[model samples]
Target chain A: MLRGICLEVPPGALVRIEGGNGGGKSTLLRLVAGIDAPTEGRVGGRPPRTAYVPERFPVALPLTALSYLTHLGRVHGLGRAEAARRAAHWLDRFGAAGHARTPMAELSKGTSQKVAVVQALLAGPDLLVLDEAWTGLDARARSELDLAVAERTAAGAAVVFVDHDPARLAGVSDAHYRVEGTGLAPVAPVAPVVPAVAPGSRVRIRAAAAPGSVLPPGLSGRPGPDGAVVLTVDAARSDEVLRTLLGARPPWHVRTVEELP
Target chain B: MTALLRYQGALLLRSQRWLAPFVAYAAFVAVGIRPGDPVLDSLGYAAAGLVPLAAWLVRICVTNEPGAARDCAAAAAGPVRVHAAALLTGLAGALLTGALAAAAALLVCDRAATGPGAAAVAGALVTVVCALTGSAVGALSGRPLVRRRGYGILAAALGSLLALVLAPSPARGAVSALVSGARSGTAEVPLTALAVALALAAATGTAACLAAARRG
Candidate 1:
């Protein structure tokens, strides 16, 4: 039971909720999402289009991912065609497009979580509430979801989330609160941390490809001196970029890997 | 509301949970109404069976979704609309099943004694009234009120029984009107009972929907 809990989330703001396990974090998020009515207090100013993603989406529903997302899109007030389009778009964006027709009951945990996230984004809701929504996602999908959250906030939507990862969207949240025993308390925002090199450091890779061999799909690089191609990518993704180049037919020869200062 | 209804209807249809109550209703009709039973009598028996079936369907619809999915839907639509959609879908399913059962009774029962037209009208009215009353029973006995599965089922069964046997229950009154009409060779429309059932259903639905958000 929560009492004397007063919180306000404005449009375009990202609010982070922090609390210990079973400390009413989920309950607070539920009230904010209008999933549950407050017993003694009131939650006002909720937008009409709201979406929520639960912490554990362990549903083995009868519908397929695409069908379930389409239904949710319509529930969020989109037309039939628009709902289907958005459902497919979001599914593809999250790298779950291949599983669109797969029955929900047969989906793996991470894929089901992807579908849950896709359903929330399909309608472009004005308010998005996420309770441990990123738990089971892969690193790629986790980053994709981070980007999606950024896009939603940029589009003037309010986002409230509770995640166990301390670095999840750290320093970017506009507001922060901690759920205490029976009420909410405002917590100071975490200071943005700056490394010697900016957090998203880049790597420059020089590779020589066979003549007349087309570059791998989705790989873009500039021609370097002496016929070598120069590719710049985030340090975190340099491995994947290298793997893609080497994994191609008649693999490209790596010349050098230099850290971008 | 339309979208919510559609979503809930899809859940009920695709889940195939409707089959249990449906088959039960069908079994009740097949076993009770023989080839030569009186038209009104068969219909009364068929309609009586629907009360419990309707309540069962409502419980199924309300609880069909896993808790997380229900929360997702509740966030998209309000909790009240979602709850109301579940209740309405169950009622709609019950009404559809009742119609089919009534039709089957009309086809097989001895309708010469009570005119087919009178039997048809009375049967349809009682079917509607009983379904409505049964839905009300379901709304009250479902999730928010009775959280435990064992107790919720007990409450629904007991509630349906009371709805059918109570002296002032609209379902009871309507079914009795059909039975008395069968004996007197006259058609009596249970308009008053219908109104009462409609009101009861609306009140129960509103209460359950409101409580869903408050009590969740």
Candidate 2:
């Protein structure tokens, strides 16, 4: 039970909640999302439109992904035509268009998560609460979600999220807090990495490819200032990306594939 | 409220939350009624047996309160409105069941001048009462009993049975009076009993709101 907790999510802010297992992170998100009330505390100034994505999707419901999303959109007060449109848009954005017609129970875990996340964003809520929403997404879907979060914050929607990875939203979150004991305490932001070798156990590679040639779907990084492009892949998938880069008809010239310190 | 109604209608349809209750209602009507039987007796017996099933439906709707849906609704509509939506859903369920009962009455009962018509109307009202009361009982006991799904359903069923027993004019003195051909002429409902049912409904609604509030 959370007690004496005080929270203020400023408009347009991206707030990251950090804590270990059983540290009350989910409970905090639920309270903030208004899913539950605190035993003793006042939640002042709740915005009119709010959306929440829970950690677990209730997939046993007898609804197709599109129907579920449309139902939620309507719940948020959108017209049927508009709700249907938004549902399609978000499903396509998350690369789950095929599963839109599939029953929620039949979708893969990753697809189900995509549906869960898209439903929260369809109405463009003033406050969005997400609890471990990124856990089961593919790399491309993850990046799409990252971009969506940035877009929402840019459009002045406050976002509260909990992701296991510490680097999930590095350099983007406006505020961070740790849930401990019974309440929230501010976390000092970590300094940015501005070195040639970035921090982490990620596999980083530099390759020479034609300018503006799109990187593979699962890799994330930047285009270069000169000829070589830099990208990072999850250590588990490093070999997969490397083979794709080397085995292309017009193969990309590989420079380095070193483990980040 | 309109938006909530539409959304809820969609959920009820696609999720098929109505299947169990509707099936139970239909089965009760179909199996119990025979041609040339007194409409009231058949209906009353069917309704009595239906109490537990209807209460189970209400209990499922009000309790457990799907975490994802509740979270989404809490942020948008607030807990008060969410409970209101649940109340609305319950009412709609009652009305639908009432309509179905009316249709059954029309199908089974003979074309009498006035008695059958009155009986049909009475059947509809009792149907609503049974539904609303069962829904109310579910709301009253659900939050406390949610984890024990079997117990919650049983409690709702028992509570609803108790309410029904007290409801008939003994309350159905109102319902039975409507039946057997309104022997005296004017039909007078036991206002005190109705007041009790409505009050229970209101109290259960309030409890549902408090449950949402204390869910943390």
Candidate 3:
């Protein structure tokens, strides 16, 4: 049975799912992939246009990378020749051209995993579900995978990947979550920030802060000894709360909290 | 359904990995034959060729990804009937190929002195029986509860027992009379045995196909 689990991912978000082994991480992905049924609670969403790479990559029999991917393309409604060409392109991209004609059984586990990855990517799924997809790869392969994911997300695709090593995905993810006993809880957003304004100009904002609403914590409209309110925010709520305050009507001409010197 | 059949058939044929052993064994049977009673020789060739073919087909039909099975079911591909039909079609094609080769060999060798017509008919019958039995056995292999190696051994044992009990006697008079189409004494034995084999094959094939369709 799936225990308390909840998650909400915005479109085009690069979300990382993390959990201990046997924590239903892969099971969650399978349920999302429509490969398994949940015992009790409902999983709500439109049937996703998705590319799911399972923990154990499943390769179809008797078909070469080209042929198998081409078949998958056809299954997704691409023309046969078009599918073949795209498949060939992906194989070459993955450095799998030398073994393009090899049957899946003959390929090493890593090679097969690459084929599985490419197959999913070629589908251009709206939601990409990758379960432990980062396992078994050299640094170079991992970099290639990161690049592929970046390209897909740049084109506005939502990607959800399960990974045991968070550092491997450091630069790639926009958001991270830990799957606990119940559901997913936001761990943090991971993005490098550039200071846009000085610290004294930064401001604090509170929850339920709406457009045109005055900034809370006595920082609205009051000038300090230095001249501006020099908004100071509690660090915990600074990211989301400050962004909301700055984006409100009248548009605060203040620097973000991090910009404060 | 047509699309599924084409997809399945193409995969099975192209894999070559699965079909290679069966082909090799069939070749071995063709090469191993020596002169004997025409009917008995044909029967022996048919039985020998069928054993490996059944084993291979069973393995192919059962070893599929559980995830893929779930996906296929979710996609509204109808029930197991369509899948079973496709698998059976594949097995039938393989059987036909083997039967044709065996019949051609019999015709060329004329070792049985039974003429091409009788040899061809017997080969076809034997091929059908074997194919059906293989398909049935393969369907059973797909069950999670059954161990494939154990199932294979059991099927082989059962088949050998049936062959031993039903095999024609080696007596020259009986064998010659059966081959010569002389209906005086013991015509009923061979005919009854063939009928029972055919019936068993048909029943098992149908059952296997049905079971596969439902489970798949």
Candidate 4:
């Protein structure tokens, strides 16, 4: 139901699409991916090789993750042996190698999402369309996808992605567009805020977790002299680390957070 | 195209959807063989069975597309290529079924055949044609039975069966004629029906590809 939207994605650029719920984001991606044709105005210059990662992965087919990726790789014109190699490579890259033999219907949400991203990246598509593809990934895999996006653009491919996080690709976006009122409007870019600190400056946070409880992912900590967990984190990512700790299942209760002199 | 064909073949094999249907259809055709009937008669039964097998394949390949695969491959391979691959995969399945039916007919149901080898060839051809016709009709329908879930595929199979069975078509009789391996008269289908089936396969296959591409 897009009304008036004119967008240009140049080669070697990263474009981000932003919109609230039901703002025609997915529909626009569909049309851009050539899955749906535009009704009135024409869409021009779509590359011959393109790949899309939908927000939801359809995993009911009776296929293993590797088998599905191999099929799609072949669909993108890779030979059998090459397709199998890339399938296994990408699965391993995304930590889904263990699930290569697992049926599509049996994968967990995070692992299934990894397979979804792997398939899109398998053939090195010229145009990559991602619709909230980062929603369910783990921290490492999510950043790995960040690196993957950078690598795709570096290789002269255009990437269009929608992620729920505003902080996503903060400094890397070549252009930003917002979906509004049945169409799209360009969003003015804002300079990223990088809090200047001494190169060696670090942040320390002390917390207490229940006995035998594991620390949350992306946070490293050890027991202090008083038995409270003393966590050391890079000053830049301290907030994220702290949030992750607080958001842990058992909830690491912070006793103190300070900068070590 | 070759890679896509191979990919599809591998995907279909991995899915194993064809196993149950193939086994069931084979058993059904075997049971229908009367000991005294012409070995070629079983071919008609096999050809008839091929219609459902083909329709079922179409349902699996065309109707049950993964949203991720469909979207991801659409722009890369184009809808035309993707849909063609799926339909061609169905064609491959049909050919395999046809070959199997031929072997079974020649081995277990050989009575009126002039030569086992010739009868086998005729049986395979008729089976393949019936399947092509079945898949073409389903592709042309433009309705993806997957929208209906369990009932959709069942409905597609039954509907194809009905269209093939009730049309007073010379298809079944024509299969019998071809498999009879007579050197002269009535050994082939009327050119009109053959022409129609060929045209339908071409036209409807292209249309089905377009329809699949257009779908969300």
Whichever of 2 and 4 has more DockQ, that candidate is 2
Q: After superposition, how far is residue A260 of candidate 3 from its true place, in Å?
A: 12
Error of 3 at A201 (Å): 13
Ranking by lDDT: 1, 4, 2, 3
Model 1 C-alpha lDDT per residue in residues A1-261, reported as the tens digit of each score: 778987889999999999999999999999999999887868999999999999989797889888898888889999989999999999899999999999999999999999999999989999999999999999799999999999999999999999999879987999999999998999987565434455689999989976556668778965554557889998877877998899878788888999998
Give the per-residue lDDT of model 4 (tens digit) for A1-261: 789788999999899999989889998988888887777787789887788888988577678888888888877888879989999999999888999999888999899899989989999988999999998899889999999999999999999989889989988999999999897999999977776766778988888877767777656666555547887877887888888888888787988889877
**Which ten-residue region of model 2 chain B has the weakest summed lDDT?**
B181-190
lDDT of 2: 0.72
Once superposed on the true structure, which residue ranges of model 1 sit more than 4 Å away at CA? A194-261
Interface RMSD of 1: 0.9
Better of 1 and 3 by TM-score: 1
Global fold similarity of model 2 (TM-score): 0.79
DockQ of each: 0.66, 0.54, 0.13, 0.48
* Per-model lDDT: 0.91, 0.72, 0.57, 0.76
- The residue-by-residue lDDT of candidate 3 on A219-261, one tens digit each, is 4454443334444564543565565556655545554345333
* Candidate 3, B128-196: lDDT as tens digits: 555554444444444432446677556645653443344441122222334444222112234444455
Q: Candidate 4: misplaced stretches above 4 Å?
A: A193-261, B108-122, B140-146, B150-158, B165-173, B176-186, B189-191
Q: Look at candidate 1 and give me any clashing residue pairs.
A: none
* TM-score for each predicted model, relative to the true structure: 0.86, 0.79, 0.57, 0.81
Top TM-score hit: 1
Candidate 4, clashing residue pairs? B39-B109
lDDT of 3 at A44: 62
